[model samples]
Target chain A: MAQFLVEGRELVAEAARGLSALALRRDDAAAMEACFRALHTLKGSTGLFDLEAMGQLLHAAEDRLAALRDGQASTPGDIDALIEMVDQVDRWFDALERDGRLPADAGSIGQAAAHRIRDAGGAPVMAEEQPAQPSWRIPPDFDGLSGIAIRYVPRPDCYYFGDDPIAITAAIPQVTALRLSARVPWDSSEPYDPFTCNLVIEAVSAAGRAEVEAGFRLVADQVAFAELVPAAQAGSAGGGPARRTLRVDAARLDRLADLADDLVIAKGGLAELAAQAESLPGGHALGQALRLRQARLDRLAGDLHATVGRVRLVPLAPLFARFPRLVRDIARSLGKKAELVVEGGDVEVDKALVDALSDPLLHVLRNALDHGMEEASTRRRAGKAEAGSIRLAARVEGDQVVIEVADDGAGIDAATIRALAVKRGVLTQEDAARLDDVAAIDLIFAPGLSTAAAVTTLSGRGVGMDVVRSAAASLGGRVTVTSAAGRGTQVQFRLPVAMTLIQILVVACGEERYGLPLDAVVETARLAPGRVVPIRAGWAFQLRDQVLPLVGLGELVGTRRAALAESQRVVIAKVRGEPIAFAVDAFVDRLDIALRPMNGLLAHAPGMLGTTLLADGSVLMILDLAELVA
Target chain B: MTVRLDGAVLRLEGSCHLEDAESLTALLQTSGVSLVDLSACQSLHGAVVQALLALGPRVEGIPASPFLRDLLLPALLVKRQAKPSNL
Candidate 1:
């Protein structure tokens, strides 16, 4: 039920976005269809769950949107008013979800929304004014495909203003084919009408009837959808016949995986006992039996783990779906011609990771629009196409998901960055002069850094990139950038597949044990004080001419320890592209463990990533050297 | 001020601003009227519409007036209905 509410809230928010987009682009048929669909989903889902208040409010808003879709209103102000109502409805739903109760005056908001819908046409004199009915026609054979069909007819007067029926029909998904025919036969004696749409549509779609019907809601009076079951052999089947896959609830899959993990642990303990028995006299037979059992358990556990992981995977379509409207809005706002291209939308990742990536991706997109993309006139002058392009691509690489946002726009100017850095005191004049273009470009990620002369609401706040970097790091990811002036710029974020279990390198500082992320650890070495060389104000070691800072692990972690003995070990770690070496007493083994949150106050302590329980009943603190070095 | 009560008809008069809305509420309370005509009024504020909405009285006025029907009426209806009174 909580999950259902979360999904419903997300749908409402999407509907609000769609409505706002329609308000911004008043004549956009697609936006209107999307808005209507969102509201319809919200209403339907609320009704299904017996959320009467939410359902009624959304129903009222949906009615208004339906009128607008049919061309009863032709003003941006009308669309804005409807959008305002949608926004209020979204807020109400959010409030209900948060507080578990509807506001006392929730009904009044619905009443006001209904009135606004009425007023969108004109003021109502009294209750006697009847809403105009739309004319609709049903398509033949609509119910032949084992699906439902619905018909909507807009009043004949609908097209007199500005509604386009074809645009609304395009929003429905799973439409295998669409054939629209005039409702009234074309006749030379009929004044050769061009504006009136008396049309019947034949569409073959697998999408649910409610979703398709909702798309046509604005012209619900003039639109009709029918569900039909396709013939058993309509589509070709490979490998004998097509098989239906079972859809298991995620919670059930998780519970099963947990049980499997417990079983694996028990098997492992049994195997250890068998090995101990073999170490004694004449226990070889027991060890062999235990080995066979351990192998079988391992196979079963591995398969179960893989199945559970696959169950948590979700496609990237939801993230990509919102970009079209975003590009339209941002391009219009900036008065620039820009197009968005998405690739690898079917690539799947953990659902939780996808949710976490949303804000960072949005920030990058906004930055691309505000600062990366060049104006149309400037692009033409530069011998490039007038319309710039932004490409978003996602793919699974090794164990990480790499999402890249690249744009064919005027790239970042290194000189400008260097000048800004000098002006902002982030870098000295000498340092700025010594730095190359690539290094200068990286300065953009520095906190409180921007080359823009004036900060706009959309970008140039000097905080976005820094936040993006930190957010990526928190998820055990890193963001990198590559730019060539006048060509383009591409920003890539590398994120882990999951946050639960992480592979870490365990090291010991004095008597305490700590785990460093394997991804951040450069190398482990045994070094004496005599081998360390001094450079600048700090001690540095030369490995290929690049200086690495030497930091004592005990001092870094504030561990009480005596002076270092003659023989000591150092573990080199990199944090945010800078390398630092931590001097430790010794290096322990590495293992993959489920990272649990640290206890109370230690959770917020610096240099600590999380905590993990070991097999020996000891707790090990995972160290985040990135945070420490930063 | 021009005020009239003929059987069930209640006539409102003069400029009816937000300040005068309270008096209208008092009049409605005393007279027990369910319908009111505001055509004689020079002006009406959101407060007047709100008061009428709170009193749950059917109102009649210029139908084509954008301010009265679109802005004032809708806003008042929204506010009053969201917060219902005992009366």
Candidate 2:
């Protein structure tokens, strides 16, 4: 059931994309075919379970697309109806995922949706509209063929209305042979309107009249059907570099990564063993052999870690593909015109980040469409294109992946945000007034302050941008916004590419070594004696133009403070953009290590980010500088 | 534009919509186009297909769609075969 829901959601998304494409271009046969196939597959999968309602709904939708592909005239609301059906199926998928079965109302919902799609004039022709016309010339070879015969003469203006007579006849069920001829003798000397429909289409299908009629139901007024009697003896004529994928449960991947991390940690023990061997008497050669084996294991462990990381990486395309339909729906609802332009969907990130990003990204996108975009009339007055454009882009910068949502609507109003912050009591009037435009814009991330004047269904619940901020922060990322009035607003989220492994600057104090995330470390400096002056009980250090309050790492972690030395190594770190100095005994080498969050009794340990195993099998504590300083 | 005149051959690619019909007719009339390639075309709007049928241009290549291939190739060729002077 879980597997079904996963793949079902994917198939639903595929169908939705295809339908959207078809809605934009009715002649997109590829999109129509793709959507039909997706629904067909989804319906078949539903049959594997007891999902009758979902199956029925998908079948209806599949039939609708099949008819459209058959050159049926699509009603204006046909694609919308199909998209709604897909959405309904998606909701049922959600229900199935949450519970083992769909909601109790699933049947009614599916039935209603299926009815809408079928009754929207997009349903397949299930019955003959009229008796077969006697004038259809039966093929001589089909003398004994047992089937339905069809002859269709489309209206001359049918082409202007988007009818394809040939496609309609070709779609007849079990079609054996087809023939076409000009309805009227062509006058070679006369120039004719090319768009005029002049062909008479005929086909012999090896199916019942009702089934055959369904294929031409859209053009039933122009088609006539006949029954062909079978002549007893009639015969019918008839990678490069490949990448294979297996869909494994995300949990299983997480487990594999955890095991790989354990292997990497366990491999550290070999180095310790090698060192111990060298310490023993007359064990030099044994130690040398052990060291060589340890080196090989180290390489293997590194390879395993790297490979697991690669395996966990997934493209962002699927996530981005979902927003086009959303943009359409929201734009329609709000009476605005907005287009979501997505780029860099091929950027690969860890599966966890991708999953975690969904809600936050969705909220940001909703905010962009709901609040950032202006109505078409307003946009025209502003001299911008009537349709507002929001560009959702992601790119890899160094080891960090940056996802940015930029909108060319009215930029965020800093003055409004400042006033809202003051009104919400998040800041004093003086405080709000004192903030610059950038700082005022940053206030959007302040909890309980919404820039929207009214709370609407789409957004403006006052619990929006803050959530985006915290979600980014939780993922070891940061969000920043920049806006220019009448121009646009750009919100950027800078995050580490992967969370499994992190680079840290190792430091030592009082015979204990600890790791600090390299991002937090501003600079490492050796301060001469007296440069560090005592301010009250705490210490202060002069680094360039700033006087930074200093804390000894030993005392901070509840260990004995190191005695003051002639020259002290002070590590300057930034916590919440404020510089702070931590006095350390020595600066150790920097390394990339997989951090294991504190578990067991140490799970709630404050100031400790996590623990990592060193090459010598000694455990190193990685400090959370921000929390530590706070 | 789904209808493009490349050299002397008119190529109909992707989904050729109704808007392409006028250009298709224009290209066939003035560009001294010799052939219509539907190989890359997924489907053509009826008007565009009609334009092809009316001009009676020599068409080459089959679309990926079986329904289209079955219907269009024959309609284009059968019309010419029935009245060779129409071209």
Using DockQ, give the best candidate's number. 2
- Per-model clash counts, in order, read 35, 4
lDDT of 1 by residue, A138-247 (tens): 34434234433444334444455445443344456665544433345434343322334444445555565456767876667665443332433122111123335444
Native contact fraction, candidates in order: 0.00, 0.30
lDDT of 2 by residue, A1-630 (tens): 776776787788778878878878987644654576568778889999989999989887777776776567889988889988997888787678778898999899989998998898744457422222367567564565556677788998887777877666656677776666677866658766667777777677766555676788888899876655344211110011122456787899999998888788788678879899999999989999999999998999999998999899998877887776677677888888887888898999988889889988888888888888888888999999999999999999987899999999888988899888989999999999999999999998888887788888888655679999978986778899998988888899998787567789999887789899998898999989989889998889777788999988888888886666899998889988899999899998888789876789997788988898776767899998887777
lDDT of 1 by residue, B1-87 (tens): 444675786776765544455566666767887778866655554345434544556666653443344433454444445543543
**Model 1 spans > 4 angstroms off:** A1-5, A9-41, A44-225, A229-272, A315-347, A369-393, A406-411, A457-462, A484-489, A520-551, A562-567, A570-582, A597-600, B1-87
What TM-score did chain B of candidate 1 earn? 0.61
TM-score of chain B of 2: 0.91
What DockQ score does model 2 reach against the true complex? 0.21
